[model samples]
Target: MSTIPTTAVAIEPLSISDRLSLVWRIPLLVIRCAANFASFCLSNGEIARLDWRQKLAHAYLRASRVTLTRKQQAQQRKLLTGPRIQGYCHRYNLEHRAVSVNNDTLYKKRDIPTPVLHFVKNPTTQPDGPTIFYLHGGGYHNPIKEQGHIPLALQFAAACKAKQVVFLEYSLSPEQQYPCQLIQAVAGLRYLLEQEAVQAENIVLVGDSAGGHLTASLLTHIVHPSPYAPPIDLRGRQLKAVLLVSPWMAMSEEQIKVLPRAPNDFLTRESIVRFSNMFKPGLNEVWSNRCDMHDAVAVWKKLFPTSHEHAICRKAMLAVGTSEVLLDSCVSFALECMGCETIYVNGQSDLRLVKEADFVLAIAPGEAHVQPGMDCALGYHDGKMMKAISTFLEAC
Candidate 1:
C-alpha cells in the first residue's frame, strides 16, 4: 500500500492564555472528574439524593464559560490585521490539526478537491470496509484539523468499523458562502463514487453541528433536485445511513425564545447570529431555508420542489444532547424523518426517550453541542457513548 500522505500540521507552543486556562481549569476538572467518578460509583437512588448530576452539570458549565470567554477574545482578534493575528491563526490553526501528522490530502478550491482521512485498525493489513463520509462541524467556519478532532475522527472510524473514513473537508464559510459548501459537498460525494469506486450503499454520511445541516442538505439534493443549485449526477447512489450529531437545522430569530437556552450550553445566541450572518452575508436564499424543527418537511419540500426522493428512508441516526439548545429542532427534524408529526421536547425535560421511525435518536442527558463525541474520546463517558454509536453503526 502507498504510504499515507502527511495531513497533520505542526504543533505550536502553548500561549500564555492556554497555559493560564490549563493551570486553573485542570485542577477544577480533576475535582469534577473525581466527583463524577464518585457519582458513578454510587447507586442510582443514592446518587440522585447526593445531587451528583447537578454538581457535574455545574462543573461543566463553569468550564464551558471559561473556554467561551477565552474564545471570544480570540474571535475579536480575528478582525485584526497584523502578525499577531497570523500568529493566532498558527496557534489555534482555526481548530485544525497540524498538516504534519495526518495522512489525508488537503484540497483547495482550485483542485476541485475533497480532503479525505482513512482510518483502519491496521492500515497495512486491513481490508476495504465500510465508508463513512464525515462532514465536521464548526458553524461552517472550523475545519476537522482542530485539536483532538483527528483522534475523534479516528475514534468514530473505529466505532463504525470503517475501512476508510472519507472526511469531506468542504470549504469553510465567510471565505466561501452557503451553496459553495453545499456544492463542494455534492462534488466530494460524487468524486468518492466515481474516482474512489466506493459503492453508494456501503457509504455512511456522518456529520456534526453545521456539518449535520450540510449532510442533511446534501441528502435533500440527492433525493430531490433543486433548480436553484446546480444538479449533481447521483445516478441512484444510495447510502447506508446518515448519522447526524447535534445538527444545527435552522437559524430563525424566533428560535431564540421558542426553546429555552440550556444553562450549560456553550454556544451563545450572539455567537450563532454573528456566524450565521458571516456565512451568508447579504443573501438569505439558503439562510431563509433554515428549519425550525417543525419545518423539516417544509424545508425539504422547498429544497426539493419536484418529486420527493423517498429513497432517503434508507437509514439514519441522530445523536443529540437533551440539554443542547438545538434539542427542539433536532426532535422536529427527527419527527420529519419518521414521517410523523413534530413533537417538541420541553427545555426543562431531561427525559431520555428513544423513538423509532426511518431513523434512530440517541439522546445524551445533560449534554451540550458535540460533547458526547468529545467526552467519549476523552474517557468522560467511560466508553458507553462510543459503544452506543458503534452499535448504531452496526445496526445500520
Candidate 2:
C-alpha cells in the first residue's frame, strides 16, 4: 500500500516587507501589461485568435492579477458577498438559507469563524434527485463571485436536475489556511449527512480550480483522515458523482513554471504561485512538491481497499480547457484516473477510453481555464462543453 504524503508544516505568515512590496509591483505590472498589449496588437499570435469578448476579459484579468493582493481580494470578497447572495436569490427566484456549521470541536478550538452553507432553494427540483455541494474557486484566496460562481452552480444544478445546490462558503486563505478550509468542507458535508439527513449516495460533489483541490482533499481525508482536521467517517457511504472543473492540481511554483504555457489563458504562473503560497504557507518538501490528490489511482485504491469497502463515488468527471495553464496537470490526473500505463503525448484519441472507465475527461477545444463555467456565469450557454457536462450529470 502506498503511503499518503504528510503535510505537517508551520504556518508562515507574510512579513511586513512582503506586503509593502505590492505598492511598487502594482505600477510595474501595469507598465508590463501596456508593453504586452502593444506587442499583442503588432503580432498575429494566439491572443489575436480569441474573440473580442475573450480578449477584453483576458486583458482585464491580466491587469487585475497583479494589482489586487490576496489581502485586498479578501476585503473585496467581504464587500461583494452580501450583494452577490442577494442578487442570486432575486434573479433565480430561489430561497437562500445561510446554515452555520460551527459546533464542530476543531472550529471552536481554532476560533475559526462559522462556515456558512449557502443553500439555494430550487422549488422545481425533484425530491429524489441529486443535491450538489459546490465549492467555488478563487485560488482559495478570493470569495465566490456573484456573476461567475453562483450562476455556474445554478446552471450545474439545472443540468443535473438536482433538488437544490449547497455552496460551502469555506473560509478564505491567508486569513485561514490549509486544513481550515478542508475542515470546513468536511464539516459542511457532515452537516448534510447527519443534520439534514441527506444520504451520501444522493450527493454530488462539485468544485472548480482551488475548490476542486478542496473537493479532492475531502475525498482523500475520508480515505485517510488529515491530522489537523476533525475526524469524519462516511459510514461506508459513496457519493453519486464528483465533478472537477479545471482543477488546480499542481501546488509548487517549480511545477507551474515547467508546464507548457497557454498564451490565451488569463491565469498566470506568478498569480498561481502567490495564491498557493498564501494557501499553504510553510510546507515540507513532500507537501511543496506535489498535491497527493493528483495520484488519483492511489487515492482510489486506498478509498476502496477491498471490494466490500465502498468506492468514493459512482462517477467522476474532469473537465478542462485545451488552452488552460493547468491543462497538462489536468490531463495527467485524468490519465491516472483512467488507469493508463503508457503515456500518449500528442494523441488525444487515447483519452477516449476514459468514458469506459466510468471517469470522463472532457476537453474543451480552444477554450481557456474554466471557460464553460465562465460562459455560464456570463449568461452564454451555447457551448458544447456545457452540453457534455449536462449529459454526464444526467446519465449519473
Candidate 3:
C-alpha cells in the first residue's frame, strides 16, 4: 500500500490568521511576542549567555514581518535565512561537544546528585550515589534547552554530587502526542532500572512544564498500569521523589485558559489544542479554519481515554501560578492520584510553607507563570523554580 500523505504535508502552514484563535494564533503570537520581547530584554553584560537567542528571536521576528525599514528588513533577512543564525547555532554545537564536569567541588552545601544509572561511572562509588532523572519542557515540540539549561543541569548534578544524570530527550510533537512522551519518560526510568544504577527510593525525578507533566504521567502510569504500560524492572532503582515547576499538567482546553495572562506567556490556549491534536490525530483542528472533523472544546476528551489520573510515585512539588489554567488541574491530578500528595506552589497565591507530607510548598512572586528572571525560559519560571528544587534535593 502507498504510504499515506501526512496531514502536515497536506495542511496549510499554522499561521496567525488561522481560526480557532486558541489553536494557532495564540501560540504563534505568544511565541512571536516572546521573541520580540526577548529582543527588548537583551543586555550587554550577559550578552554571551543571552544575546544570541534574543538575536535569533529578533531574526525570527523580522522573518515574520511583512514590510520593514532598512534596518528591520536587513535584520529579518539575516535572521529568516542567514549564516549569522547558522553560525550562532554552530557555536552552540561546539560548546556542547563535551559535556564534561570539573571534579573540584564548587561548594560543600547539602546537595543531592541522584545520578542516572545509565550515565554513572564506577571510578567506583557504591550503589549509594545520588540519582536524578531530568525532564526538559518546551510546549511538547521544543527541546532547544542545550545552552541556557545544560549549565544549570551540570550545576544541579554537581550540587547533588551525583555520579550520573538522566536527561530525558523526550519525543517532539505535531506528530507524537499525549501518553507518547510520557511513555518514553517511563522508558527512560526503566533504562535506569536496567542499568542497576539506583533504586526507586534513591531516584528523584525532576521536570519543568511539559517535563513535569510527563513526570506526573510517569508516576501515574506506574501506580496504575495500563495495557499500554511498559514493563518496569524495579530491581535496583527505587523511584523516590518528583519535582515539577510550572508543569503543564492538564491537557484539556478548559484548563489551558487557567494560566495567568502575561505579555509573553510561553503557553497559550490554542497551542494546547495544537499539541493535543499532535498526539491524537483528528484530536482537534485549529479553529481558524473550520474543520468538518474536529472540535477544540471537547477535543481533549476524545484524545486521551483516561480522564482520571493514576497515582504513581509520591509527589515532591507541583508548583504553578494560580493565574495559570493548569494550576487547578495539577492540584486535582495530585489529589486524585490516591497515594500522591503535592506541594501547591502558588505564583499568585500565598507562598507559605504548606504541610510537607506527600505535599510541599511554593515561591511565586506575583510574576507570570515562568517569567524571565524568575524563569529560565523566556516566559516560564525555571530560575526561581530551581530554588525550590535545591530545597527538595537537600531535604531528604
lDDT of each: 0.54, 0.69, 0.44
TM-score of each: 0.66, 0.78, 0.56
Tens digits of per-residue lDDT for model 3, 326-393: 55555554443322334434332322343334445453332234322233333332333455554455
RMSD of each: 8.4, 7.6, 13.4
Q: Give the count of colliding residue pairs in each prediction.
A: 13, 0, 39
* Candidate 1 residue spans exceeding 4 A from truth: 1-126, 145-148, 227-230, 281-288, 291-310, 337-358, 380-385
Tens-digit per-residue lDDT, 368-396, candidate 2 = 78776667655676554565566668677
Which 10 consecutive positions of candidate 3 have the poorest summed lDDT? Answer: 1-10
| Candidate 2 positional error at 244, Å | 0.4
> Candidate 2: where are CA atoms >4 Å away?
1-56, 63-75, 80-83, 281-300, 304-310, 337-357
Model 2's TM-score against the true structure: 0.78
* Candidate 3: residue 206 Cα off by (Å): 1.5
- Higher-TM-score candidate among 1 and 3? 1
